[model samples]
Target: MTLAIETFHYRLAHPGYCAIPGAHPGQMVGSGQLFKRHESLLASPDPRRLDLRASLLDPFNHYRVKVFQQHSKIDVLVIADLSASMSIPGGATKLQIAADFLLSCAQSAFESGDNFGFIGCGHGIEKKWLFPKGLRMGRVQELARDLSRVRSGQGGNGLFQVEPYLPLRRSLVFLLSDFHFDLNRLSRLAGLFGRHAVVPLVLWDPAEYADLPEWGIVKFQDSENRRTRTLLMRPGLKRKIIEAYEQRRDRLRHGLRSKGAEPVFIEGRYEASALTNYFLQRVV
Candidate 1:
């Protein structure tokens, strides 16, 4: 699908999240008018946020930004998991949530004039697909539109092999996903740690980490499969389950730390506001 973009009746300098210390961003551009764009997943057009989400967009919304000014421009690569198991229900799918985080990153990149691009990967690509490279303010929407259609297909292993695209030289890359996959992916992840600045985003739902209400027997289906599994949830069992979840989380964190790369966590409840706030505090 093609993207449609025209300078709105209004214009403003778009700053990303916030300016880095000692890094001076450029000018200010106010909100522009609303317009329609075909989203990646749905059939109809949706209203794109031109400027209504100003607060969420940190320092950028108010100041000017210097594009790609870094002696070595941060190569911003946004990667998301489209694996089927990652399509857990609660709020948005993991892929969509990743897209939102990436969109925010893209916005910041655009304003800063950084070398930005993105790749939405899953099982495999038929025909061919383009991994966007270079900062283009308009391409952020193009990415959201593309991401809306990501399908999580059921398979023996929903996890993907993300090794080939690694060792980005002096670049900052963010890999956002639920990461309920095989540890085999980590060998390559280690290489990434040695070479690039990798920010790992861990997406989770409350149900995965804690117990729901003690509302009696709950019929639940595995997020990876459609089959239903009924299980009784008592207070004791709930505590045990939560403990086990915590243990696993600690293990994951330990593993990443050992290999390198600090993981930033965001739960489904974060929504866009919390998500943006986290980015501002961490990456911006």
Candidate 2:
């Protein structure tokens, strides 16, 4: 089936709380908003920003200085899992869904005056997919096209290699992955986002657990290992598969949360508006 890609608008949930210094002039509190009075300064005071009334009111005529808030810009980065699991044949492949989501984020960041970047990881990170700062809308579209053509392969947590490419300053990071890798390895990866605003998008397919036919033999393959196995599809077996997936979900959520990351689970397709709403709620 053709993928139904939806586009939606988004805004930063919190516009004033970025820890790293930003370059763009904005309403956020920073060192760039001049001509604004904050408090008194005992050491050096700027004559231009001196409060005449406050200085005159003081018995000793102590000077009061005006402080300006700086305008800051944030970097938006989209990190995708390009492992074999993401290439599953179905209504919408995980990578395809990720490309659409990345497009939405690019649009949102562009509108909000933030730089956009993208990185794809499979066996190791794909350097071709890395779009650094100052990416235009046309460039984003080009990257999306390239993303659709890349193939998945055996990769053991290639995401761990992405840390070096990240911006030196704090950034708004969106991670798209199935989280099918070893759970123990996830904590190390999650810790990398401790100082940044991170959103983990978990892409799950219904066929992974819910599409099994009753009372039939089926073949299963491990996407990462390329190992195949045959098993009988029974009600009890299906139930167990689903239960195992749920347990893994819980573990993933807990593991990520422990490292200051929250996982947003999405099945089948993604809605940009829903994602924006989720960010709005979380940021507030």
Best by lDDT: 2
What would the per-residue lDDT of candidate 2 be over residues 1-284, giving only the tens digit for each residue? 12444554434444434444554434554366554454566654556667777877867667776677665678888888888888877677877778788778888777666688888777786567676566888887777776666565657466888887887666788889998888888757754576667888999998888777767998999887789999999999999999999999999999888877778898888778778677666761
Q: Estimate each model's TM-score.
A: 0.64, 0.82
* Collision pairs in model 2: 22-72, 22-73, 30-69, 30-70, 31-70, 32-69, 32-70, 33-68, 33-69
| Model 2 residue 173 lDDT score | 85
lDDT of 1 by residue, 1-284 (tens): 21222110111122223233212222222222222221221222223422344334544444222122212224567666666666665555665666666666776665555667665556553222335466475666766766755665544231244445533334566777777766556664666566655677888877654647665787777656578888787788778878877776787788777766657777763244554454555542
Q: Candidate 1 — what's its lDDT? A: 0.54
Q: Rate the local accuracy (lDDT) of all candidates.
A: 0.54, 0.74
- Every model: Cα RMSD to truth: 15.5, 4.0
Best by TM-score: 2
